[model samples]
Target chain A: MSHMEFTGKTVRDAIAKACEELEVDEALLDVEVLEESARGFLGLVGHRNARVRVRKRDVLKEVLEVERPDSRYTNIKPQEFSEIESFSKSGLEDGKITQEGALSENIDKSEIVSQAKEFLEGILCRIPVEAAVEVSVVNGSIELEITGDRSGLLIGKRGQTLDALQYILNKSINRETPLEEKTEIIVDTEDYRRRKQEILRDMALRMSQKAKKSLMPAALNPMPANERRIIHMILSEDKEVYTKSYGEGPLRRIIVYPRKAMPNKRRRR
Target chain B: MKELVEFIAKSLVDYPDEVNVSEKETEIGLILELNVAQSDLGRIIGKHGRTAKAIRTVLNSASTKRKQKVSLEIIE
Candidate 1:
């Protein structure tokens, strides 16, 4: 057993110094200040006193473990395969899922869930956007909730981009999952995709009306490939108007051009 | 044993460019340091670290071939 104490001007300084001396991850340890740094007279001499307790041996053991591996095990931890198997069986005991159920039957549910989450996160991180994507396991399916501006880029038209992501995640998980386990996965972004479709339809009507009034072509801002497709599909029936998608790749957008004279893009019930 | 673990770790991380592996020789076995980009550290570790454990599982299986013990750590 071991302990230590220190006095400093502030808790932050004391903790930082302790971390420097400890040579361990700061997150792993806890810190507390017993008293405030005393500023006596003209802030010249008195300082705060604090206490720090460290798991020196445990931490040292971890460092040494990282520094050197136990040669006897040859760097492998003894695995209890039967224990994992039993855990899987318990999930099936509820009868909601079977041991033979799709991919879930043969694999560890927790393990597969984790892989799916990480794999999806990687895809989102690559996209340069302020929005965030969160993955959840709901009813044995993967649900991706996206929050940000221009979320249509992620959902795509008819959920194509979302589909592609699901396909990629499925492939990655299977490759990593043990051979004996089978787990099926799905991904969705809340109701963002559905709501976007409605909004696009409304936009199409508004643009057609403007074109009819102005009797000149109007161009909307650039959108992702999927959303652009939706705009085109929505306006295809308007005899008085036409739609075109410009730009390239993911940034491409739709432009709705109205005929020289028309009442308006009719409201479709 | 060390080389194989490093190869897999590198492949699993999005920032493969940032993957680094160090081997420590011990009296009983060996310790492996798997460091990756702070941004990519989560991907390697996975949600709740399930993916990280899976990677360790693969490393363990490979280690079995050489009759040795091995463990993996994710350095942020």
Candidate 2:
């Protein structure tokens, strides 16, 4: 993530400059107001400009490796498919398949898939982009994939656009469905979710090593809550370091600290 | 308090003139009912009601000074 500081007559002015220079919407950038402007002597002498630091929220550039073909699911044995099918069929007959029927008695997997597809189509129509949505159910999760020439636009920078779409879809679904029965809904384009996860896992490993070596905390750029959770999960089992999220609201960042640097006891007052 | 909700709703929606805010006093507190143009409903509520939550947060802070409880309702 590229961060820059800007000074202006007011905090809003500095944010405006950052947005203009970065060529991104104000809402997309994570902004920190460092200092408020000060006026003295009739707003002419002894005046200080407000300062702010702004950066793109998700700066995965350094961590993102060259795009590679996803092969995680390619190694499944052909003979196991029949066994899994029979297992699922029996599970469904017994009404023990929560993934397909958890949300609501009246709502089914096909209904959720169609509703998701329709929602995505509505967004695409507003964007005036031509694309075909392919829906698939894998292990009870609904996956909506957009495949077309203009699908790149939907992915946005570092898949932020796709994340926003998924967030909205999940929120709408949860609002309509009971909390205990809700299932995961993933929206993606060009296998972005899987690819991003691989990259994030790699980044987490590298950052933890750096934290251990330097004995100093390593703070990552702000990311969506789900991505932050991925980083936390990746390092949860490590004994040498621990991850903590800091900051407020949407600008929260994940920091990895060496275990040795942690304070062992609280100081008495 | 009603004017505050109205002002925020008007600023967020495209149809500012159609935004209407009404207050109802109840036994527990004040209820501010916000009505916006049908098309601009999403803008006021925001994605997953985050905007509405933010608006309520600000209203709570403002109401604290007057020692009154205020709740917001985005009426369809």
Candidate 3:
């Protein structure tokens, strides 16, 4: 839908009014503040109302952008995905981060939770999605669960978008921390990661079995690095099947190669 | 294959009594599903899943002798 302009005494009021009109969470509305209200001369004689352009962020288009057949996969590592500008720009665009409190080397769990929540809120405030960032400590890593109406879009096709967001957040947060120790952060929405992991594991098994039968390498469709890691990890120690990534970016995919019938070439660690 | 997996899982897991192995015959050949006590779950899996992989290797050898297909599933 086309964006409509809303006017209020301030930017916050203008966004609030837009949210009320659209019946969506403030996070879901794409907002552009055109003019800021000003108080001049007398108390309010020359004050002009703030003007903003408001519209629902088109998640369908954003998902299509992420899932397109060409150039859908990132590098083998999540860290490399952060440098992918075309794909990540949408999620990180206009994201305003406030570096109020610097992280210490011996940071506690509550501090990590609060800082992560702050980073998430800052990023979500600019993105056209309404969601609550729930942060907690799992093991030594920071876990963030984003829950809201528009959260499914964040998952994107095959979770490439979600992974990109995570890598970006992890890289940036660590950059802010003045220490050699790095913190791992896992971002998940609606338990998507767990479900995806289970699905990937099963598919890997079924496909590896097929590869063993046909005596040919089974090539899986291009998947995010994290998902690919799941396949590699599950079958790493399998008796008659070994897995490896076989292509370059975008066209890159996993090939489950079956071990030889005879033990001529024994693969050693 | 069922008995083979049962024997291995029972020996590897702390709770040998809790080890359960079920066999299902499918077109692919045979599928063995295994369940063990949650505490001993990591024990059967071992480091980098070395233990489970070894069990599968033994089962594969036996399956070949029987001229049938078999795979193991470690149920969480």
Question: A26 in model 3: Cα distance from truth in Å?
Answer: 64
* lDDT tens readout by residue for model 3, A164-233: 4575456445644533346778988878889998999899999989988977567898875557667766
Worst 10-residue lDDT window, candidate 3 chain B = B57-66
TM-score of chain A of 2: 0.54
Off by over 4 Å in 1: A1-186, A249-251, A260-269, B1-76
Leading candidate by lDDT: 2
lDDT of 1 by residue, A1-269 (tens): 12344445566667677677777576856555556566576766654354444333445335324322113222222222222223333344323433345445533467667667766565554343355666666555556666663535555545655655555455466655453453556666658657778898898788878877777556777764445556666666676776654444444555555544333332122
lDDT of 2 by residue, A83-120 (tens): 33333333444233343353353345787788778866
Which sections of candidate 3 miss by over 4 Å?
Answer: A1-109, A177-180, A262-269, B1-76
DockQ of 2: 0.02
lDDT (CA) for every model shown?
0.57, 0.69, 0.66
DockQ values, each candidate: 0.01, 0.02, 0.01
* TM-score of model 2 (CA atoms): 0.48
Per-residue lDDT for B24-70 in model 1, tens only? 87876888888888887776776556567556654554455446777
TM-score of chain A of 1: 0.33
TM-score (0 to 1) for chain A, all models?
A: 0.33, 0.54, 0.53
Q: Which number leads on TM-score?
A: 2
Give the 10-residue window scoring lowest on summed lDDT in candidate 3 chain A.
Answer: A94-103
